[model samples]
Target: MSGSPAARASNATDHDAEQLRALGYSSNFDRSMSLWENFSLGFTYLSPVVGVYTLFGLCLAAGGPPMFWSYLLIGLGQLLVCLVFGEVVSQFPISGGVYPWARRLVGKRWAWMVGWVYAWALCATIAGVAIGAGPYLAAMLGFAPSSNANIYIALVLILLSTGLNLVGTKLLARVAMFGFLCELVGAILVGGYLLIFERHQQFSVLFDTFDININGSYLPAFLAASLAGLFQYYGFEACGDVAEETPNPGKRIPKAMRMTIYIGGAAAMFACLALILAVPDMAKVIAGEDTDPVSTILANAFGPVGSRLVMAVVMVSFISCVLSLQAAASRLLFAYARDEMIVGSSLLKRLSANQVPSIALIVSGVVPALIVCLGLFMADAVATIVGFAAIGIYVAFQLIVIGALIARAKGWRPSGQYTLGAWGLLVNIAALAYGLGAIVNMVWPRMPDAAWYINYSMILTTVVVMGAGLLYMLLAKPYDKGTAPAGDAWELSRSGSHATGRATSQGFQQAQ
Candidate 1:
């Protein structure tokens, strides 16, 4: 039958290569992931249940009931960012989301810097997500939430995701699909049940200002709460990261990016609303009486049995987040490596017997595992690294947005199934503004009592990431593989230390 497994596999691989050629590149990896899998990768990366669940308590503690509204604002802002990404990825459709887009649209050096920062951001995000899972695991399993336990669990979680990715894209796709069902359905059901039968407060309660701000100004308090939402919406660009392994990536990847924001954004908003409204006592929740307010809400709304059941789904969401995170990180590595843009490009691009970038996959896991190990001794490591994630990703996204704007201003137009038409400039401007605003808000320092590093952690960490990237660019000074001379290979010029090669085949002419 045409639908037989073997036949489908052959068709998929052929289609994938054909699509890659149409986008001005040749396929080097197995295209085992279906469109559903593509969508799932983004969805799980933007895993609403995991994002909202992890951030809910922190937002509540920071701004009391008013914190949830930031989700709405950030959701709308990030959607603009996603659309800009959609437009750009529609035109590029390269494996590395930011690197290829920036290289082609901006310049080679700019692309290298963006890729360096984004690569670390992705890795840090995986570690941050894993570390965030420890507390929930502790609450559900009766552990003490010790540093050692968190470190071990985070390491185990990263390894599990790494193993799944190493197997093949097909299995990863299947697991991601399963996770999509559990997290999305679990979110809807959990939210609906609480909204229908368990709400202790009215919808109006969210508008109330508890005046929890010690400085007497609500602005800072609300801004503090906004970080929670800001952190939740990134990683959707992950669809573009796996574009090489996806069939018809040009059109499908953009759609998946938007759909991830749409569905996951809705799920996060609804779930947070449910938890806020279902609080048995708002006074106690706001007064820090319920240390684990989210868990308390779930446990109170539904009995222990139901709460644990939902926690099980949350656990799945956490693993799914890590899987999607590591998978995207590996693709970013492979993409940059294949272009010979990084140190050890030859080794990093080597594929396994299964046609996967095995070294990239393992490197992706190892770096995050080390980050997790750092969390073992530093309890505050989770917040700082996640701060890096929350701020770092938005910065990476805005770099691309700025590049796209510069391209458009210089007469670049998108050629794809998705285009903004007359509103292209307008949308791009909005995206840039939103991205810049979010970054400032997240990076703006507030704590003056604590040490400099702790108070300005986000800003300081971001500077460190960028400074390190600049240093690497100066030292490594990797070559730019313009176009292949004959095939998909860039023959290094037998010349000086810095060799820029020309295309070996016909496609977009390499700028030299």
Candidate 2:
């Protein structure tokens, strides 16, 4: 490769091909998603409206008005995580966001575990998000919301999203763009109206944590409040999950990820603050009353018609979120299946005429439906499943972050256009620390009055999911025991070695 124009283009193409070849596949995706479309995918997945509207009441209940600070704190922490992820995705820019990043930075088995947790998380997120939307959907359709009814409605929503995912990327992109607009614009208009025209509490309420009922302890209440940020900031990695379909992925994916967090965080905080500030009775809220502050505030600020209108917009955002999560999950399945990793690899890796992963789509779609159906019987099952979705994604994130720090200690360096460079170590360590702390917060036993198992449900569910993943990897050994790569993609792209013209032949080398 020389300094010629054609040489640069050839080098870039070779880079893409080489990355795929190392992953044991040729290009199979459409790679037709524009920057805005890529941004929309992540934004819709993050879906400020989805996260905020779902957990706002719980967050408000946890710590009263001071919960707004939790969102602020969570945003900063997730920004750090996103920064670390940006550097990783900038280097890999592959499908299966956490899996590929960990695979390359760590090793195959490690990455398999990453994919394991992430895939389940994505599937569960699909279920959790759909079921969470049931009440709004039920209200919209004039159906009495019940556990059984919610299950049926959630399954129907899942079916719609699954079909939407299978249509075509072009159509998917159009819908995602629409969701992005509706969520961002709707959040601004609704929050502004609630804050300005229908304010019940003054701005000083945000600083008041006195009335919060964390058994008279501030730390526990703050930690509980942190759940909002925890749930809201993730799903931005949906950008990196679709990197293969993105043009100029190395440059664009990182930006898309950061934008997803920044923009989504803004919408979530504004809406949450508006609702918090508009609550008229803090003591009643803390006294096990006004359980549905989100819906209550919307209804208070805007009458039934206006609240229903907003609920309708939220419904659209929920469907959009489901569509994005399923799309991302299908890609995870497809990415692993391309290497014959999963149980139905051959089928899952098969592409439809539209160039989408056909069987993977079915797996991603149907599994969540089955999971959400559990809501019909199990007491508090939906609540626990929703908790799983939030914590599961966070666990997947930390796996990659942990792997990055390990790789860094062993001389791994950023090989992409975007990198933290001299500050990479500091950022990675801080992000890792934040992740570990957050994980503890998530797993902490908050339900003191409940049974032991029920109180530790999140920890138990996470363990079961991870245990299943580890067991599958131990038995399946998904990585091909191959030695044909001239040099591993990491080596090819990790430094200037691609230009050195050394070891471009065919010899396999593992990342570790």
| Strongest candidate by lDDT | 2
Instruction: Compute each candidate's TM-score over C-alphas.
Output: 0.90, 0.91
Candidate 1 lDDT by residue in tens digits, 1-512: 34676665565456556445644577667776777788898899988888888878777877888888888898888888888888777656678788787876677787887888898888889998898788878776765787777778889899999999899888888999999999989999999999999988898989887768757788888998887788888767998888778765656778888888888888888999999898887777668787778878887877777787888889999999999999888988887888888777898888888777889999999998888787656768766876787678888899988988877766666654466778878989999998898888887777788898997898888898999888877776774454422111111112211111111111111100
Per-residue C-alpha lDDT of model 2 across residues 1-512, encoded as one tens digit per residue: 24675555445556555655544457767777888899899999999998888887777777778888877888889889999999888767778788778877777778788888888888888988888888997767666888887788889999999888898777788899999999999999998888888888888888888655566678789888788888888878988888777755777788988898888888888988888888877777776688877767777777778888999999999989999999999989887876566777879888898878878988998999988877767747766766788788888889888888878776677766578889988999999899989989988888778899887988988998999888767876766542222124345455555321222211111110
Off by over 4 Å in 1: 1-19, 22-24, 213-215, 380-383, 480-512
Best candidate per TM-score, number? 2
Query: How much lDDT does each candidate structure score?
Result: 0.79, 0.80
lDDT at residue 491 of model 2 (Cα atoms)? 58
Segments in model 2 whose C-alpha atoms lie over 4 Å from true places: 1-24, 213-216, 481-512
